[model samples]
Target: MILKDCQRAALEHIRQHSAARREVAQETIAHLLEMSNIAQEDFPQALSSIQSHARVALHFHPDRLSQNLTSVADLLLTDGLYKNQFETFLSNGALSPDKGGYRDLWENGMFGEVYMTAHVTPSDRPKYGALNLMLLPDGPSPRFGSCYFLLKPHVLPRCTFSSTGSQLNPPEKGTLDTLDGVLAALLTESFYREFALGVHNIRTRQLIDHLRDNLTKPFQDPSTQAAARNLDYFIEVQVHGPIWLADDVEILVADPSFKRTKTGMLLEKICEGYDIELFWHCGFVLNVEEVPLDFRGPKMPSLARRVASGTFLDVEMIGEAAADLKRHPERWRDRGPYEYVLQELKRLWHVLVKFGKPNNTQK
Candidate 1:
């Protein structure tokens, strides 16, 4: 998809103040245009179309939440695009590791782990909806960085997601108003209510305290307690990069780390209290390096094609596919044109970020 006049000007404006490397954004935009033939005017519909066909993963750190459960709104940048109190910590480079942003120390060299995690965690999942989160399995790898909230059709807009990542600056002050129709939904009171209620339902103070008490250190010192209370509020309604979910998306938990485990039991208890249906998947995803190529070009295998064509509606099919793969691991595992689907989907995501409504509001 080629960028329109307003889209081109928007990118140019972002480059002027954005901490994101200019070349990185430029290359991402160029690559996506080359990969997708979708028209510029069709981007909004294309955004929903791609996600409708893929599984979405919402990653989170359980231990960190256990310490101080906060809203997705709480995790946004305060400095660069949406200046507020939270960005104060980011600009000062005072953010803790668990909070997952860069300090001045490494801000120049690397993107925030929070944004990077969102990047590496592909929006595309197999038709069975199994996720290759950070290309690692469900156990205790640095890759999990956080656990996930897997859903079939995610609620967040594609325009909020960057195929690369966004830049975070210090106290620069920005707003989603520029993104117009795209992010205007985000700033609405209904959106704020959805976020607050969702987080409150998923992890309450009681749950946080329970998880914290179980932690080896507990972090109950007076100073830590004070900080936790202060950090708990939702000061600004902004998306630093991506807003992972809305209240309606069904939650799925599929980690061996959550199966028969203490945390898993607690999670189930929490879901039960909220009347939330928590589904499960086989705990592994078929991992591969790159997309497979064929005579016509790249292609996805049967299951992925089901997802891409928007026919993957039977939730039972998820378990069925998982069971078959488990029974015949040699034949059906790690052998698909999975990366091809991911690349094609990302073509839409990159276009959404560059020229879609949220970022290209000038039009």
Candidate 2:
């Protein structure tokens, strides 16, 4: 049968199947196709239509949990059209020996990783995910970060973060004093309870409130203040959370001297009795100083153009591809099929990026 026929049959089958079953089928097909020789361009219109229809149908489906899973998959497959390109670029960049396992650094001339994953539900199998937080001279620049929580469909609820943390250090005169104060304040009865309970909910707003309430208090003991000042730098806490389909949270600090081991230990102690994984990643900032002037074309655009186009899909794709490569490197052992997908994705990205740019006629 032709591609159109195949797609029609697939859609029909999906309509008849339960949401969970449809997701399993979709994932299986995605894996099979990843190793196939099919060209992406041949079915752009079809893919677009199927994805759109699936999205609407999923929203109205009876199985809310399964619908959410399928919706996320659909969005990953089609939404933010540039997602594929971003993934391809990041994958190639990360694996490139010259770039030293960093994708954004190689292609975009910036350094950072976008953390992501597919299996959000807690499983005995290693929960698939990625971490792309790179430390920079100015501080930690989380270009595109994501974390997934594994919870059943009926029990799952959407969560959101109120405000992100800043890398900017507080004033100098009070830097040492502030750091000491914040650390001690986190130990107060009220502060400790809020931090423990709020983090469990994995709500960004609650975390921020907990941090603000606890992190701003002054230290009363002189000995503790001295010890805090002796430390190289104060931990700058940036909160990220309320990830859909997953109970997730992240704390990023701007201090280059921040020790991952120490931070992890401290967090574990602070969160003693809480049931969550507190990951600690340390790396320097990866900033794109410039997009090669000549690189601006159908494939790559000026920062301004990219921003105007709002190609979030592309950014997401990069994260997804990166996560897949990290989680399942064995699946892509034969590089040929992966290369084919990457090239085709690049061509598509070029075309899509230029879809609506104003033509220059005053030459």
Candidate 3:
């Protein structure tokens, strides 16, 4: 069976099983059919099988549309803090706009700046606000980060702490290299998290665990093994917000650290081993208030006076500094400790990707 004939039959089955979902399924199937027609000559048996699969899908899962929407809403709510972080970064000029600043920014400083809103009541509609996150150079070097955020009343957030090289001296000279590395790392992490979220929804824990176990396995083919070895390392995490809902989480990336030289090295290594090409870009949305604020020292006052003043705003120092000490602790001791939450996220991703696969063994 030709691929197009298979798609047509499958779509017809969908149309029969779920009249309400026909429009949505038809549009998608049409595109697939068009692509298949352009690539293949003819295959009648394959077409019959495809139609059978479509029929099974439509009959077995009619509520998928609503479920998908709910899942997306949940992610947005849970990752509220991360969204806020991205928003703050973009608004503060820390990141550049790309594609006119659509939900997120691109590497070229262009973004569509899209906004979304939901109606909570007949008379009251709340705006979800805009997310204008994008990647921009941190300095003159090839160092960049995807900055993004979400907004609501009376909320201040901060971004998570991740490592990065020092800003470049002549920012323009290496902007492209830095932005590309950052974007690639961002995409890798984002995709990883997205895969996890999808898998978790279907309650596919065993499948997820299987994939994690295979991460260290050697490929039977040398070429495949080489490619896998060259792939870049990335960390994806679920950003939790104040909300307690299950779907209220967003995925974020933490690696590629905006270090151009290191990113280049990683890319070269991957290229040597695999035939794969990396093209996607990733952006993060985090709240700025979540980040700890920095404080300055007093100039004219004695060390004791400066310590007392710093303790007032810094919770970490309040208890320790209350007592008298022979030697004052360093400034870092007074501030909150840096925390890395990326590991927890990676675990979640490990689960989601498994769920994304088709149920059939043939997949």
- Considering every candidate listed, which one attains the maximal TM-score? 1
lDDT of 2 by residue, 88-204 (tens): 223211123222343323312210111222321111111111111111111111222221111222211111000121112221111111222222222221233443211232222
- Ten-residue region with minimum lDDT total, candidate 3: 55-64
Name the lDDT of candidate 2. Answer: 0.25
In order, the Cα lDDT scores of the candidates are: 0.28, 0.25, 0.22
In model 1, state the lDDT of residue 348.
25
Clashing pairs in 1: 78-87
- The TM-score, computed over Cα atoms with residue i paired to residue i, of candidate 2 is 0.18
250-348 per-residue lDDT for model 3 (tens digits): 212111212243333333333233322222112111221222222112221222233333322121121123222212324334332211111211212
Rate residue 309 of model 3 by lDDT. Answer: 35
Error of 2 at 313 (Å): 12
Q: Score candidate 3 by TM-score against the native.
A: 0.18
Superposed on all Cα atoms, model 2 deviates from the true structure by an RMSD in Å of 25.3
Distance (Å) between predicted and true CA of 46, model 3? 17
Candidate 3 deviant stretches above 4 angstroms: 1-25, 34-80, 85-252, 256-363
Off by over 4 Å in 1: 1-44, 48-56, 61-146, 150-159, 167-249, 284-363
Query: Which predicted model would earn the best lDDT?
Result: 1
Q: Estimate the lDDT of model 1.
A: 0.28
TM-score of 1: 0.30
